[model samples]
Target: MEATIHKFEDVLIEKNEVQKMYVNGEWIPSSSNVTRDILNPANNQAIATVTEGGAEEVDLAVEAAKNAFYKNGWKQTYARTRAEFLLKVADKLEERKEEFAMLETLNNGKIYEDSLVDVEDAINQFQYYAGLATKPHGQTYEVPDEIQAMVVREPIGVAALVAPWNFPLVMATQKMSAALAAGCTVVVKPDKQTPLTLIRLFEIIDEVGFPKGVVNLVLGSGAVVGDALINHESVDKISFTGSTEVGKRVMKSAADSIKKIGLELGGKSPNIVFADADFEAAVDYALLAIFAGAGQICSAGSRLILDRRIYDEFVDELVSRAKEINIGPGWLEETEMGPLISKDHMNNVLDYIRIGKEEGAEVLCGGHQILDGDLKEGNYLEPTIFSNTTPEMRIVQEEIFGPVLVIQVFDTEEEAIDLANGTDFGLAAAVFTNDGAKAQRVIRKLQAGITWINTFHPTFNEAPWSGYKQSGIGGDLGTYGFEEYLYKKQINTALEVKPSGFYKG
Candidate 1:
């Protein structure tokens, strides 16, 4: 069978009663009745309108999730049932994947191919958690005494799931599927800038016969709806993916109630290229690491650590290829890189490019925005590379979430390690080298939770995904991620019950 391509207009959602907040298994409008236009960053045009929700709607969603967890038996729901529901959602999503991909491309401004990958990742999250739902949970322990003891994992009740805009569907599902699979009811909120894909996901959840209040979505700014969701007394756990600044705020808000939190936050990851590495593959992955998604990714390899032996040649080659990256609308089949998430983001990146130059970093290539004929209206910028950067420079230190990369050169392995771990962020790091033992040694020394050897951004669902230092708190994928929505309780039973001698003293 041949692959099918779609026109953005052809796969658009049918306009009905306008997209609304989903709560308690019902499609409803926000009490505020405020609406915002969802824009295509590539063209700066409104793709859809989503109702804005505030604290009032968050309370409602939390109430419904609480009721589902406590009153509707969702807390102790059978794992097999949860697995079945998850499988159903996966099947339904696979059926509508093309439409989902189109909507994602239109809404998120990633290349159409990247959008399809995101949709597939979302589906895989559901399926992975589906099997995990039915798998054995907890562990048995052997005690020195006569009592038999074991730990059982239970649902953590109501979970507040916050997603970012960059990879809308994938991030939302990364939080939602794990919570639902763990038998916890949820209230989901996508970043206000991009909520279309998540709204459609709610529609799918409703169709898959999930129990009322088992899942809900509240759409609004993080300042309003997000604050309410995190600070709500009934919310048991919070799973958030976004910037570190916002993540810090979330940690504080969650502290008000001491809620469990799993944050996949900001990163300025280092991609180190040693001279002995396969030079061509190194360049390939280096481009993929930072340029993919137009550098909106939190874990993008924004810091390129190059060995002095290959520094000049590698920088020249990288700049040449980055200059050729086809930038255009996401819906285009040939666009290698798309526009930033919005105009503000574009300006933000351009400002960083300016900062890099001021900080005495040489602009190897791409130091401005793309304002050419057809691309004038869009939030597009050139893929930028900055060399001759120091560890103390702001451009090397800050998390510029854009196509702006900083290059750092090191002479020895120790210097490379220091340069890689110098920043405050430790979300991810990669080493491209042919030496097997050196790869292992360097990777072990790197201060990052997610690391790659001779690779860039490939991650597996079976392994835990997390960060060290300021990047984030806790994990987001794999068994560790699933357990984030669960509560561990130890059950102890005496083999023979008898009253022990009581001491009055």
Candidate 2:
């Protein structure tokens, strides 16, 4: 398929030579002169440069966030009034959806169609949190002996949100909308590799007249800016979405001050295909399970567990369909998958494929790079499939974070459930079965934070999402996500001014 040429300059404003970070409502240069080039992984080209912030910038950003929370009307505003601002932000996002979506594709190498969904989800998140904003408060409880008591939910103050490169805008708003709804000030550090989309999004945020310092943006490498944000004393809470290894570091750093933390981390999710499942439907979903986002999704169903009865036929059909997917640049209308996020990531995925072959797993199809014609300069990996895999292989044990699917056969329902629960990461899993009773059984038995029955990768804003065990801590989305930014307090009031009977006696 011939890829379409996306002239980003036509849609987006001319690329500013250096995109300045937003701090205290001002677009300013970094404290240091350092900067990083944001690349378009589609062709390994530098698309834009952003000011790379560090400890000094984080200090300023956190201080600004703290001031906005304590010394301004943002926290004191009525819930409905806050909801109005959120609604406006959502409207603005809708108006500029295409521009942001295309920018995301150019910046992150995700298919333009999928990137549009990210923008739409971001807009919906703002709207959902806008509704929730009006409904998050304290409750009054009846008490005895002229004592009245109530529980109040208050903002946790300055929040530092660190978003990942994979789903930049959606994850940012997932945390940002919730924190803002709870009336907390925010300092956001978008991943340095793909900061353009969020930078554009923040322009709308600033235009909406969100109080100065209410929403701040910093652009920098994770080591310098991210560490400073997590360690800052003024930051009351931290919400991060990234790898599990980094999540541990964030948790340890936040533990020292007992700062509130919410983490949405990695996964090696399983997709079980039961013998009784609709054969064609399972095949289609299984393809989307791993190939969607080119398997860069945190919850990508990388482990395919097949019932022994359907194992041979299913693997054959899956390999046949995998070979037919169109691979090219994300902007192409016909392209089904895009390149890996970056050259380094592409190498990492390729290394896993090599390791799978060395470990004696059979490659059913696609185990090499596609460097032909227009794909030569890009980081395009053939959607690879490895069959005859075990639960103990490194390819099965660790997250490849690519479009490499490992196949495992199961003889019984118990074995399928056990294999799904075998991994250390329990972020997400799906069970494909025609029987409602068996679906319920598998859903209950699976150890993942999110589960799908006869479906794959479908999520809504109304539900909470998190993981079990090493998948990290806390959750995002839904009322649970909104509450993560809030701290509760109990008020005990005396209805009558009377001394204690014991003291009087």
Candidate 3:
């Protein structure tokens, strides 16, 4: 089928035409020669025929990255030159933001504006990491016992960046720019469901003049490509963003070779609402937090904890507004919430909603599929909310990764804190209140890496993105993220003039 959206014609939007994976700076077919058609989630139509790869293709990419890091000049290349390449990539992306944003919408099933925002965020990450590329990464110290002492940060070699389908470019650039900025050669793999945007981004990376073998892209299932990259002995690091279930597999496989791993995994975060909060603002942000990407975010505020005083009124208001959300094709200007990534996922989310009902949870607003007109073909579900839910319910305990929010009522700040920190995942939490002291005290007690006092989700590029518990290890974004790509070494020199050497004995 031709691309449902004509705007993508100028971009790489041909139907059923083979798009090759990037390896050693060349676009090539997978070793297996297997291919899959990538469909637009908005209408479930084929947009591009992308090659599916396996361990052989992954080995080739890893070898290329290993060669680039050790044999090529990438290891010895000056930091400023690396910074220049990152800045150039950011600039090129800036120039084609509209084109890239449209592609994101067509491929990922998010609103056009959200797609643009994600693209802009990706550009900002590249630019931010570019600045860090030239900045000082190590420090010299004065030690009383030593003539000279210092610690230097060095890039980890041969990184494998495994990204997810949600926010494909944003998540890809989060790892790619940082790895490149730290002077680590990378083999990147986008999730099989959504490879078009990253494929196009690779085109931009090639145009920006990265050295051949410095950066490579292998597109395939996480079971194959992800496993190969994780277990590859030559790869010094593995950076992945996906579900916690797969993350466990990643941690196990990386242990086989002791490769350093950075993971930004799953979350079933809580969004708390106090009665004293600016009611309208709280309502707006709650909707934005859960339904923004159709709630396919790792850090999405899936659990909504409400103060008992406003439980009835707040649920009523939330449901009233949620019913008005403009659900349609992502390419349309009026679209607010788009379809889920695929039919299987849409059904998975629906299954959770069904489970919620079976567990005796109250369905407040939406609870079914959107089967109207053209939307019937797409993977669209409603912005559902469930109340009367206990902490033991599956809807409250698991990462549904959809626009389904479970409502919990709390009478006191302590109970709110309990509900917020009740889950196994600690990726993110938010509290909305007019009481500053309460906000501070409650937010501090909430167990999460990223927290907001009065907001739901606003992840800045300058700050660290991390998780506390099963949300996975290490982090992404900011200095903490940059540090993940590097290793610190201690150096000390004994003064001969001072006769500090003891080897003569």
Clashes of each: 0, 0, 0
Per-model TM against the reference: 0.98, 0.97, 0.97
Give a tens-digit lDDT track for model 2, residues 1-505.
Answer: 2223544554444456889899999998997888888878889888888888999999988889888889977789788888988999999999988888888988888898999999999999999999999973789998898889999999999999999999989999999999999999999999989899899888998889988999999989899899999999999999999999999999999999999999999999999999999999999999999999999999999999999998888988999999999998888888899999999999999999999999999999998889899798999999899998988999999999998999999999999999999989999999999999999988999999999999999999899899997897899999999999988999999999977778654
Assess each prediction's global lDDT (C-alpha) against the native.
Answer: 0.90, 0.91, 0.90
Once fitted onto the true fold, the runs of candidate 1 whose alpha carbons sit more than 4 angstroms away are 1-5, 14-17, 502-505
Question: What does candidate 3's lDDT look like per residue over 1-505, in tens digits?
Answer: 1333556667756665799999998999987889998889988988889899999999899999988999988988899999999999889899989889988888899888888899999999999999998998788887786468889988899999998999899999999999989989999999999988899888998898899999999999988888888888899999999999999999988988898999889999999999899998998898888998999999898988998999878888899999999999888777889999999999999999999999999898889999999899999998998889999999999999999988899998899999899989999999999999988988899889999978878889999999989998999999999999999999888754575467887
Better of 1 and 2 by lDDT: 2
For model 1, state the Cα shift of residue 260 in Å: 0.7
User: Which of candidates 2 and 3 is the stronger one according to lDDT?
Assistant: 2
Q: Return the number of clashes found in candidate 3.
A: 0
User: For residues 1-505, could you state the per-residue lDDT of candidate 1 as single tens digits?
Assistant: 0233445766665544468999999998888789888888888887778889999999999999999999989987899999999999999999988889988988888998889888999899999999999998778889965889999988889999999999899988988889899999999999999999889888889888888999999999999999988888999999999999999999988887899999888899999999999999999899999999999998899999999999878888899899999999888777899999999988888888888889899998888889998888898888988888899999999999999888899899999999999988999999999999999999999999999999888887778889999999988889999989888899998988887658655
Specify the poorest-scoring 10-residue window by lDDT in model 1. 1-10
Candidate 3 minimal-lDDT segment of 10 residues: 1-10
